[model samples]
Target: MTLPSALLLAAVVATLWIAARSWTLPAFPGRTDFVLMQLSAAWWSTAVAIESIVPDPADKLLWAEMAWLGIVCTPSLWAFFLWSYTRGELPERWRLALVTIGLATWAVALTNDAHHLFYTAVRPVNAEPGAALVYSHGLLFYVVTIYIYAFMVMSIVVTASGIHRATPAYRTHYLGFLVVMAVPWAANAGYVFGNLTLFDLDPTAFSFLMMDGIFYWLITRRRLFDLLPVARDALLDAVPDPVLVLDGDGTVVEANPAAQALAGDHAAIGRRLADLPGLSALSTMVAAKPATVSGPLTLDCGGSPRCFEVTWVPLTAGGGGREVGCLLMLRDVTHRHRAEMRLEDTVRRLDLARLEAEERLVAEQEAKRALNGFLSMAAHEFKTPLAIIDGAAQLLLMDAEVKAPGMLPRLEKIRRAVRRQINILETCLADDRLSDPAFALRRDRLELPVLLRAAASAQGDAAPGRRIELELDGCPARMTGDGPMLELCVHNLLNNALKYSPAGTPVRLHAWSERGPDGQSHLAQSHLALSVADQGIGIPDSERERVFDRFFRASNTGTAAGSGVGLNMVRRIAALHGGTVTVDSRLGGGSVFTLRIPLCEEAPCEDRMAGMPAD
Candidate 1:
């Protein structure tokens, strides 16, 4: 083959090699288009090489016409290749338009003998050696050339656009892409518009083949396809948070879809940060140029207020890692912000309620002190008058013979009434002391039967005719407790029983040494049981629990002279001794009030129980 045809064949082989290598590469954006572009260049060179070798002018013209297949496809496919490879993807309509133009150009060029719109005439320049055919120009030829040049220009423009956006490492690769676009475009432009040729043949295929070397270097050495525009798109578009990449001047450089939604009606890209009112605070903070800072930021989104946690980090680049811009990420925290506000409101309300409760407690305590003082003073002052009345009633018994027989009983009744009043006053005083904070159970060794017998005797004197029964079958002769409190407890129980029951009815008092659970009298397992049983107005079932409350009385206790405090005071004394007071009775039946106090608080039950013998 002549050197010219040999060069054309070499270009074809190189382009085919590039296509074969690109075909084996892992698929990425525009990889198919790139491989097709190389194949088209190879086909174009093959057809041109045939035209260079053929002898007859008719044969050369036929080959030249056949070459239009690859010639028409090459430039348009190169433009498409660059669009998919760097611009991420070419729109379908543009791709279809490129394809239609290529197929229509091939059809028109093939039928030039009839329409002659592509070439008016075709003839061989030299068939001897290093020569090929030339075609006379037609209107469609320049039109097609212009459009092909337009495709290359678009590819160059689109590829160059990304050089600024790419990192320093990839920016070199983008420049390499621009070189790839310019090679065939410049060669073809020179041949068509400037009458340029390489060895009497078009130099477009030769330059295009040389471009394959640069593309190979970019793919293999520069790792071109690894960092595709598609990856950048997927990463930025997938983020749910508003991501804004700003220049050092706080002008918006790049904003994803989320940022667009957040900006609402405002056009984001190319706009200054101050242009967005919702992002003004973030813009100011970005102006300060902090390395990293995050806080609450509120934004108006579609007329509804939404809160976000705006985070700013300086986007640094290059070997020096100098700040290029700030990446503002606004994470939605509306739900969290509103919840915090509600929690703060609840805490404030709780604090106010606590203050009100404390104030009420203090006021109630003062009122209680005043009421107790009045009762104590009143009790003290009336005792003298009560004593005088009791003495006068007794003295009238001495003069019973001077009066009617009924007068003696009437005087006796007056004395009994006065005694009951004095007992009531004494109960009031005991209740007052029980309520005192300083009041403590004065535990001392005492006789259980002796205590009960004395309490029984005191009640008997006050009632005149009521029988006070005492049963100390298993009672310990010695016990440990406050003598006055225990005696007072018994007196209060007996007093309540006698006052509520019929005047002729008798009340029973029982005391025993009782064992706790499992019949073991060790540790807290044992207690002393004292119960007062009286056939009186019994408590209703519903009010049984409340009967021990201070100032609480049974429903059946109608017209019964009671301060409603004696039983409450008894319960208080029992509790102070680490025990409880319980009642068991049915309505209209007698009630049994039992007080159980632990006998082993300080020591073992065996020691406290051994102190007394059976009574």
Candidate 2:
């Protein structure tokens, strides 16, 4: 075989073999453009091989024109593939424009009959048995040549710029790509300069076979196009997370600024994770041999304990068939960890406080129940004996004149004492009933003024020496409530006024009614007020609220002979009627206790003034 024919056959075989081998390797960065560039080189080789041996000059010219298709497209394809192999992505518009320009130049070269812009003239070979046809160039041919050279030069420049910045394995791969691209470029240069004239061969086609084998070896063995290096200065230093890259033997190969800061004063690169002072916890995690582990880990780092979320990621090669190294990333989680701990402590304390409060509440409720039982039992027990004594005194009073003159008066005093004792017992019993939650209001339509008058009369009868003046004037007669409860409430108030005042001092029991004094009405209910005013020792303002609490009496009451439940029962009775009892008093002046009930309807106005009666 002639030298040019032999080279062309070898070129075709090598290009085809590499294009096929590309499929077997795992998909990598530039596999698409690599396959296409190889295929185009193969096509060009086949056309060149046919053109070299063809007997007819016309057939050779046709094949030479066919071969131009690969010549025009191969460099641009290599340019794009190199860009994608080194950098990450190519802009779609740039890739498309490149392919369009390449195909346009190929079209011009093919349709040279119309324009003659690609080749000024085509001449047949001065044949030595296996000589290839050569063409004279036109303006467009040089333009296309320069265009092809620009693309190849750009591919070389892109690869060369990244070599120093690339990691060791990546630098070797980039150098290999540059060398393979340079083969065809140098061969074409030699041919153009008339330096490679052996047997009239186009050396560019011969160089394709050399390029194919180099690329195939680079891809399968070196993994040249698998991963590319990013701009380390921009990405690594600016990232907030600490990142460390280690080699196969666990030596730190790269450390970002964050990683350096985390490692303290010492440099981290070239040191093993086990040797790092601040990364003891991280070293232990790496030693555990887990494929991936991530969680909170604490490091003392020569100061207060710092917390980090540590991640262990093992780097792999050959689709995880080989272990390259591991990546140790640490992110500061101290603030988050402290906040979570504080929240946990707060929740724990609140839980303890809540349990204590619940226990106290249970104890208080038990004490209240015990007090109520004692009061109920005492009242019942006291009432039975008081009734018997009251009956005996009444019988003795009727027959006292028959015994002695002094015995009659003594029996009368005994009757009054028994009646007072009975009143006290009744007050205690009322307190016990009011304390019960099940005691519901049994409402009835009754004349409230009549109830108040009866209560005043009863009080005067109970304490004959203490005068109580009844004033039911201007009060609403009709009201809805439990008549007995309201009567008892009024009687308690009258008794309080009489007991607190001096003997012979007038205790004023007054009743009145009102429509809407304030807008604070529920369902537009009206109000009926019964006030007990005393010209006796008065209450202080501070003691008013507490006076209505169960078994609570004012401090100014001063050893008064009384059960404390009388006013409390009055307050409860008022609440049952959806009303309130309020007090007005001074230290020297006597006090007024007012029981105001909510009437179901607006009361009819009486033709009387609102002020109290004069002495």
Candidate 3:
């Protein structure tokens, strides 16, 4: 065989092998049609190659018939392949019809010799032995040629439509298919109409071999049949989060619909991220480090500031861990960011308020300590002078009584005045000591009537003109409590009663002990109530509750020479004994101050003030 013929035969063999291999590939859209089209191409190339080197006209005609059989089937198979490739599968009926038509055309061509329909006359073009045959016009040949031309036009339309619909990445593959298919059509047209011949053989077979090679190259190198572009489009385009595919240099290679909108109106492919206003910060981050996922990146998107969490995904080549590209995903986090800012602001305000309150509390406590120290020092100083006056008054009273019996009452008044002053000083000293929480109560069993008599006698001595009386009504004879504090509490009440009441009015001390509901209502318990009743100026309704507050003086105690701490101290002492003090008064009708203490259980005590100390 000649070298050219040998090469052509080898090409034909390779085409057949490729067609067989393509048919065995896993099924996908247009898979069967692709295999059928390739097989038709192989068949045509084989017959044409065989016809080229044959010597007999009859043998050439037989080979030409075989070649024509493949030729007639080629366009229909190609059309079906486009239908499946572009539109994802033809209807079953449409596929069947195309197959039937191709088979019928081949049958008609087989009997063409009887009627002179396919070829009117046939002869070799070179008039040399082992040269390819040439054909003259026949009716059947023209009819089949027109049918094939229609399919060719339809395949072109299908491929063009496919290219239009393809992604930017896959459009080149569809264009390659169109260009390869056109090569055979162009070769066929030149041989039939323009009389262009190559090496005394039809060039259509060579074009078919070239087209098959292109198909194999496109499928292998470009992965044209994998349909990954479709998958990439379906998943990435439909996602709401902005996604970007970047090359190793951080240039944007592909962007989805959301990313395009985020980047503003422009083409994104092949553009560097730094060129975009919203994504420039991301570009800077990626440039610094190949892969990093840090977020809450703020950007102005379409004139509105929004927060987004950015994720940087490294795209590696296969499993080799070689860095190839990157993927950026941005998720919106505006609401969460705003909420965090608000919470931080709220915490700042609360911290300021807490600090201010702490400062105020510290100042108040310091002032109270200063006031308590002043009271303690002043009471101690007054006691010294008060003791001297009381001793001098007693000595004068005795000397006056002995030397002049007529001056006895007047000197006795001087002694009572000194005693009253001493009593007031003692009250201040007791109040200072009671301010200390660690000061223990002095508990003892003492009769309420006896304490009441003693308090009345002291007040009667202080105010000689005032009538003092003791009224005892079923009062307990004895109870356990702090005797000195109780005596001070009663003495203060008696002083107020005698001091405020008119000189001739009666000041009554009423005492009672009874089984009744404790003020706190803890079952029935024994109680002793010591009341100091006087017909004096009374407390008003408004200041009733505040009468027991420290340093609170009644409004209507007109020009009354008294310290305001009396009632407050009384209330404190009563509370220390698990008791309470209250008042019932009317304007101009006078007031009754009552101290009720719960009685303690019977116990033997050697000392009168067992639980209390004099200090």
- Which structure among the candidates has the greatest TM-score? 1
Residue lDDT tens for model 2, 28-62 = 65667777788778778788778777877778777
Better of 2 and 3 by lDDT: 3
TM-score of 3: 0.50
539-579: candidate 3 lDDT, tens digit per residue: 89898878888778889887888768898888878777777
The sequence of per-residue lDDT tens digits that candidate 1 reaches over residues 513-585 is 7887768535536779988999987889999988887788887788866767887888777766777789998
* Model 3 misplaced stretches (Cα beyond 4 Å): 1-374, 401-413, 445-448, 499-505, 516-524, 601-615
- Sorted on lDDT, highest at the top, how do the candidates line up? 3, 1, 2
Cα-based lDDT at residue 461, candidate 3: 82
Q: Please give the TM-score that candidate 1 achieves against the real structure.
A: 0.62
TM-score of each prediction: 0.62, 0.60, 0.50
